[model samples]
Target: MLTIIPDLPDHIFGLRASGEVTKDDLQQVLLPGLEKLSEQYKEIYYLLVLETDVRNFTAGAWVQDLIAGIKHLTEWKKMAIVTDQKAVEKFTDIFSYLSPGEAKGYKLTELPIAIGWLSHKA
Candidate 1:
């Protein structure tokens, strides 16, 4: 399941995921939400909190993720992935170099720090 992260500032687009997140979640919930958020904020400050493992996502979901990412390629500002897995964290950190904007991963314990970092303007 995917749901919006509440109580965030206008500049941030945040979501929390648990269990199995499917393509429908992205096509229906995630993509439209980003489109709306991006209309108001040129740069997308994304925060995704994963309560379940990344392996839980279906194959179609991964495709939709890529599509959603590419749809807003130039508008990315900061992406903070909140997951407990160290490998995922390291991957996000390394991939940040190839991305137009910053990307980082944090443990659930560092969620507050992640949000704070994204909240600040560069």
Candidate 2:
């Protein structure tokens, strides 16, 4: 399941996930939000909080996320992934340069700080 984190500024989009995420979740929740943000802003700051209960993403969902990122490559300004999983942290650190803008991985406990850093323009 995925739930939006409300009360953020217009340029930031936040979500918290739990359990196994499927392709439909991306289609139903993420896609619409991304489209809306694209219509309103030149760039978006995405914050994804991967809770411990969030086990993993289905293969199709993972693929969908990849496709979505590629499809909106230039629209992403910053991506902050809050996950305690070592693998996720390592992967983000390794591939951060691949992002169109900046990318950072943080522990779940540091979510607020991550948001602050991503929202910082300079």
Candidate 3:
């Protein structure tokens, strides 16, 4: 399941992912928020918290994610992925350089700090 974490700073877009995520979850729960934020802001700060190891993503969801990232390439301001999973952390570290703004990974215990970092101006 993918859950939206509300009440973040106006420019921060937050999501908590648990269990398995499907294309429907991305389409139904996540896309609308991104669309709304895009309308209001030129750039977006993103916080993705992996509450549990993702069981897996459906093939369609993987494609959707790629499409969204490409479509919003320049709109990303900063991105923080909070997860205890080592592979996830490394994945973020490896690809972070591709971001126009800062990108980092944090342990789950550091979620508060991640939120602060995302909300802060760079």
Candidate 4:
């Protein structure tokens, strides 16, 4: 499931992923939200909180993710992935430079900090 995190600044987009993530979640929730944000802001500030393991994500969900990323290859300003997995967190931090914009990983406990970072773009 993919849940939208609300009450964020208009320039920031947030989502929470839990349980079995499906392509439907991406298509119905993520894609529309992203497209809406893209229209309102010049650069996207995406915050994703992962409550489930990546293994739980359906293959189609991964494909949707790749497609979305490619579509916004140069449209993001910052991205923050909040997860409890240490390996995933570390890897996201190290490989973020290759992403379109500045990307970072934070432990779940640091979600507030992540939101702050995303909003300020620093």
lDDT of each: 0.90, 0.83, 0.85, 0.90
Q: Tens digit of lDDT per residue, candidate 2, span 1-122? A: 77888987678889888888889989888888888888888677888898844447888888889888998998888888899897887777777788777788899889889989877752
Please provide TM-scores, in order, for all candidate models, with all chains considered together: 0.96, 0.92, 0.93, 0.96
Which 10 consecutive positions of candidate 2 have the poorest summed lDDT?
A: 52-61
State how far residue 87 of model 2 sits from its true place (Å). 1.4
Instruction: Kindly provide the TM-score of model 2 when superposed on the true structure, using C-alpha atoms.
Output: 0.92
lDDT of 4 by residue, 1-122 (tens): 99999899888889999999999999999999889989888678999999999998999999999999999888978889999998888888886878868889999999999999988964
User: Mind giving the per-residue lDDT tens digits that candidate 1 earns over 39-105?
Assistant: 9887789999988889988898999999989989999989999999888899999989999999999
Best by TM-score: 1
Steric clash pairs (candidate 1): none
Candidate 4 or 1, higher TM-score:
1
Q: CA shift at 61, candidate 2, in angstroms? A: 0.5
Clashing pairs in 2: none
Which regions of candidate 3 are displaced past 4 Å? Answer: none
Alpha-carbon RMSD to native, per candidate: 0.8, 1.6, 1.2, 1.0
